[model samples]
Target: MDNAPLVIDVAGINKRFGDKHVVKDLALQVREGEIFGFLGPNGSGKTTSIRMLCGLLTPDSGRGTCLGLDVLTESAAIKRQVGYMTQRFSLWDDLTIAENLDFVARMFGMKDRSTVVDKALDDLGLSGRRKQLAGTLSGGWKQRLSLAACLLHHPKLLLLDEPTAGVDPKARRDFWEEIHHLSAAGITVLVSTHYMDEAERCHRLAYIAYGTLMASGTAVEVVTGQHLHTWEITGTGLQGMGEALRALPGVDLVASFGATLHVSGKDRDALEATLKSRLRDTPLKMTAVPPSLEDAFIYLMQGSQDQFQG
Candidate 1:
């Protein structure tokens, strides 16, 4: 072991698929035992970059190490030490949960497959559903099973691509709880997600768009750096009001939360001045509010160009 605090330290990574440049000059350092997130819009190269980090896929150009192993030369070594879960369910749905776990253990060729499978099931709280057909399980249960399957090989790093997508709110919370527990146990995690709430749960976050890096920092730092202002508008016709604000200059994001409208823009003076002018003459009421993570993300993305060509 290198005794280094970082599990992934890479620089100037790039990837291309024929005419398409999927990732561009990306560099990142992920600390051991921290929940670091890679957040971006769809087709933003998050997946490609993550694959390069864990040695799952080769980068056309890059120099780095994962778990003190060369990302390019020691790819097979790194692959054995990482747990990867994809955006879609890839487990055997026709088999029981216990059978699925046992299969994964067998694939890894563990010396004690039964012990590992039993421990995995018990650790993930899947003992109750061990005999259930995976195809009949709900999204949450399926997520748990997927996680258990990944952990069967005793990986040091966990790479999750939107693991909580389509899961219910309560299940998402439970999933996060398990993630935190794993982090506490000295496992490094690199996750990709779009949910602001989930991003907040991460120790640090990196934002990417159009195959380029944007802002990366703690939640508060990133939010503050965006320099966005918000206005909370509450009244009837809020749905139409959102549409009206969309075309207005200086408005980066106009979203509704139940009965209220959140309008955000990077330009503080222009945003306040513009919304003041818009609401001054109309009957609509507006109140200046603090900018949030979602507001900052929207502002950052608004500045991105569609360079992905997808």
Candidate 2:
């Protein structure tokens, strides 16, 4: 993996919409055949950054190559080789599943369109519902159809923006299975998602908050990089305990997880001392625990300065 050639390499990229600098100086490297997860809060420039990487939106200032083509000078060629699935369902709902795939193949000027569409349908398990109207399909089916369409032209790199949003757990699982299969076939994927479980599935991931890249690494590396010490407390007054934990001197994160509260801080000694003192006479059970990926995510997000906020 260390020796894999980078399929998406860009640096010093910036984009602005009027006075709002949407994406700050951004730098990223995604290896070929790697599933690179892009994660961030809403309005954090995930979409904008994805567009810039895939050639849909030019960076205001940057120099790099995506698919060996210059991002600034060869965006048209870059668009041809990349498959981009938008956040929303962008296909024509009036068309049938088969019709949608066939139309996309046509738009790409693919040879033997019928054969291509047939294989796509069979590959995605859409052959049985080829004639079903896209609008009548459930969210899962629609998502499958969207993925089939994206794979029609056999793009080298796939840019998926929250492809599993609003789908059932089973559907999301199935979709990830397909993604892994594609990665195994040497198709690089750059996917943006809000789900922590989904982020963990990626081979590597980067967290961006408000146009700034906060962290990029494997899940374990990211979790370790935060240097946060965490404790899990279970008690009857977890809600009240969480509030009090947030007010302590060293506590930086206090989040509720079901019946337990995950309280974390950068200063382990201070956090432990404060908690031990606060729960000295209480019945609450406290145990030192490793911080979760979501803990690191929230920590990174909280530490970032949102450009929109005054």
Candidate 3:
């Protein structure tokens, strides 16, 4: 990954909207053909940082290049070679799948419009529904169409903002498969998503909170960096146990996952001792488990001060 050329290299980028500082001295580097996932809580400047990286918004103070084009000076050129898929379905709901692709192709002034449209439809499995109106399509199909439209320009970099927000599980899986396919084709993808499963699928991840970057690295690296210890307990009557566990010494977080609870803390030995003493008389099954990405993220968020909170 280090040997690959950087598709996005920016530093000290900051942005604000009146009194709210949305992004703060952010620095990021994305390699060519990398699937970089961005994770954060709401109003954390994930969207704003994406725009700055792609030249959609100018930074208050920063310097860098995106695809070797000056982000501040050559935004027009950068925009031409980038495909941005917004969070919302921005395609014309009234237009057919094929018509929508054609319209996007026309906007980019692409040549051989028919061939491009046909290939896009086929690539996204929309050919069978070429004549179907986008509004009539399900969330999954609409997502596929949005991706197809973004690719019409043959962009070198793709900036996707919550591309699978409301998509079903099966559709989300299918969409991730397509993203991997694109990365294999040498297209760099920077996507923001709230789903932990989706975040894990990325080659690397960055977690931002309150306009500040808190953690970044491969999924394993991020988890290990936090040095968190966890214990998984599952048994009957575990519903109200989470609140009781949180107040115990050495317990930092208690998160429920279905019928199981993951109790985690930063101090390993202390946490183990505390859990052992507390559950000595109970019949519940307890096992020491590795902290999950979700656990690490929640820990990071809890430690961060929300800059927007009054």
Candidate 4:
């Protein structure tokens, strides 16, 4: 535990409800100042794992520490040192932007709430709309406000669940930019997102499904480590092309990449053989391509929900 290369260190973690096993033998090591993306389908224990890391929820089995504090025994202490921004907007809708920040600062018992609120508003570029009501703000502004409120307490770790669900692309990029800034400032952030572009921006990632840890690494490493091979076939009539590719042996994922269809599978030789064999009758040009992260993700989740074999 002392030598684990992570700010949040846990091993063989397990949890369950009355009937359903929500988490099983979960393990993770998230480094300090790293943006670790927790990728998974809904109800797949992503939120439960984040809770275990920060000590908000107790695991039925296994052990770990967060910020050097005992995850089970020092949960209250860990909670005080973490900032959690849930998927839903938790702030008061009628409060002004400045009021929300001020309230949050006061919640942390800061000596100078006004000063902290002012700094947070200015830092998040919300000073211009500091007086605007939270209910009247756009999704981007609401996202900014949530971030500002979380930062008001100045916690070391930020746990964000689907932080960019509805914001525009520019706003999402801006949010990610701010996350990187926080990482540079030595603040560790664990974010769960559905967007692939956002996943690529993380320092490293862990994919979970059906209460199991599927994969974890940098984007390139995760994709390459899957040993998946892809083929980009360019031609018309792509609507039915996916079916053809899926029917071909060894092909697991057939997704469109703009005007081309990216066909991928775990077995390289078999996949390539299928692509070369199937395209002989069509004008589609077949070329081997590298598997993208999304392709690997699709492959990883193929049979995950089939049944509880473990």
Candidate 5:
């Protein structure tokens, strides 16, 4: 990672709308040719932070650089070098696939509009559906077209906001494959997502909540950083077990995954003692397990004070 260039470097960025502080002194760095995932609950300032980083929105107070340009004063230059794919399908629905690409190229004032459009179509597998209407396309096709349009200018950095939110599992997998392909070609990607599986796919992750960053590291690092002890139990009478476990002295979290119940806490000895004493003669099968990404996020959320609720 040290050998790669820095695509985005920003610090001390803050934004507020009315009296609500959306992003709070956020700092981040994205290396070239890396897929960095940004994650948080809804209204946690993920979108606001992404916009500020990519130069789409200015922060209330901060200074930084994006793609080597000043994020504040050089936003126009930074905008020209970055390809932003918004959460919504922001393309023209009335236009055909090829026409949409042509329009995007024209908007960017590209001299080789046809050549760029053709290349984008082939790269995103839209060549065969060149005449298909954007509005009539499926969610997956629309997503591909949006990506294609973003690449029309051949930007070095990509800011994708929940690019696969409504896409099917198969389509999401295909989209990620294309993203990896782009990354291999030296394009830096910053994507925000809610799916844990998608978050795990990134090289590194930053989790935020209530306008503040909670954790930042690899998946394993984040999970281990929580210093949580988890035990999974599979049994027949586990309907109300989650609530009961939450009320116990040592348990900090209790989540049910189908037939298994995951009980976790920060205190190893107390948790173990409580489990051993409570389930000594029960028919449940309990075994110690490593804390998962979801477990760590939930733990973090539980401790976080919601900045908007008050």
Candidate 6:
């Protein structure tokens, strides 16, 4: 991964609307053929940042290159080489799957529109439903059709904005499989998602909150970088344990996971001491466990100050 050239490299990018600062000095570098995951809470500017990178919206300030073209000057050229799938399904719902693909091909001005459309249908497993109305299809099928349209231009870079928001688990898995396949074929992908499992699938990940970048690295690195200590507590009647733990000093997070409670804190010794002292008379079992990506994700979100709150 270190040997690959950067497909998307930008720094100090900022954007604003009226008095609201949307994205503030955001910087990122996505490697060639890499699946870089972009994660954040809702209203965190993930979508806006994506637009700036893909030439759909220009950054208010900052300078960098995308696909080695000047982001500030050659946005049109960048847009041509990049395929973007929006968070919402933006395709024509009244049109059939095949017709949608044909329309996208026409927009790209491909001379061999028929051949390109046919190949796209087959590639994304949409051929069987080529005549199906996009609006009439289910969420998974619509997702497949959106992906097919994105690839019709044969773009070198793919910017997917939560492509699986409402998709089923099976369809999400299939979409990710296709993503990995595309990466192997040397198509760089920059995707935004809220799912931790999907974030772990990427070669690297970046977490943003309130339009600010808080962390970026491999899954392990991001988890370890937080230096958080976590303990799993299991026992009967664990209902009120979370509230009790949250009130204690040194306990930063207390989340319930099915049959167990994951308690985490930044101060290791203090957290351990508090847990032992509080639970010594109880029947609960406390076990030291490694901090997970989700733990780190929540931790980051908790620490971030919402820009709109003021």
Candidate 2 regions with alpha-carbon error over 4 angstroms: 305-310
Clashing residue pairs in candidate 3 are none
Decoy 4 TM-score against native = 0.94
Which residue runs of candidate 4 sit more than 4 Å off their true CA positions?
A: 1-5, 307-310
Reference-based TM-score, model 6 = 0.97
- Ordered by lDDT, highest first, the candidates read 6, 2, 3, 5, 1, 4
- Clash count in backbone of candidate 4: 0
lDDT of 6 at 40: 97
lDDT of 5 by residue, 107-149 (tens): 7789988888888888877788899889999999899889888
Higher-scoring candidate on lDDT, 1 or 4: 1
Span of 10 residues, lowest total lDDT, candidate 4: 1-10
Candidate 1 structure, TM-score to reference: 0.91
lDDT of 2: 0.91
- In model 6, the clashing pairs are none
- Whose TM-score is higher: candidate 1's or candidate 6's? 6
Q: Rate the local accuracy (lDDT) of all candidates.
A: 0.87, 0.91, 0.91, 0.86, 0.89, 0.93
Instruction: Count the clashes in each prediction.
Output: 0, 0, 0, 0, 0, 0
lDDT of 6 at 156: 94
> What lDDT is reached at residue 181 by model 1?
92
Report the lDDT of model 1 for residue 49.
88
Which residue runs does candidate 1 get wrong by more than 4 Å? 1-4, 306-310
TM-score of each: 0.91, 0.97, 0.95, 0.94, 0.96, 0.97
Would you give me the overall lDDT of model 3? 0.91
Q: Which digits, one per residue and each the tens of the lDDT, describe model 1 over residues 1-310?
A: 1254988888888999998999988888888998998898899999898888777789998898999998989988888889989889999889999999999888777888888888988887878878998899999989988998998898899999899999999999999999999998989999999999999999989999877889988898899888778899987766688888888888878877889889988777888887888877666789888878887887777778533232
lDDT of 4 by residue, 1-310 (tens): 2233577888899999889999999988888889999998888998888878777789999888888888878988888889888788888999998888888887778888888888887787888988888889888888988988887788999999899998999999999999999999989999999999999999899999999998998899889888887888897766788876777788878888789888888788888788888888888888877788898887777758655553
lDDT of 2 by residue, 130-164 (tens): 89989999899888889889889999999999999
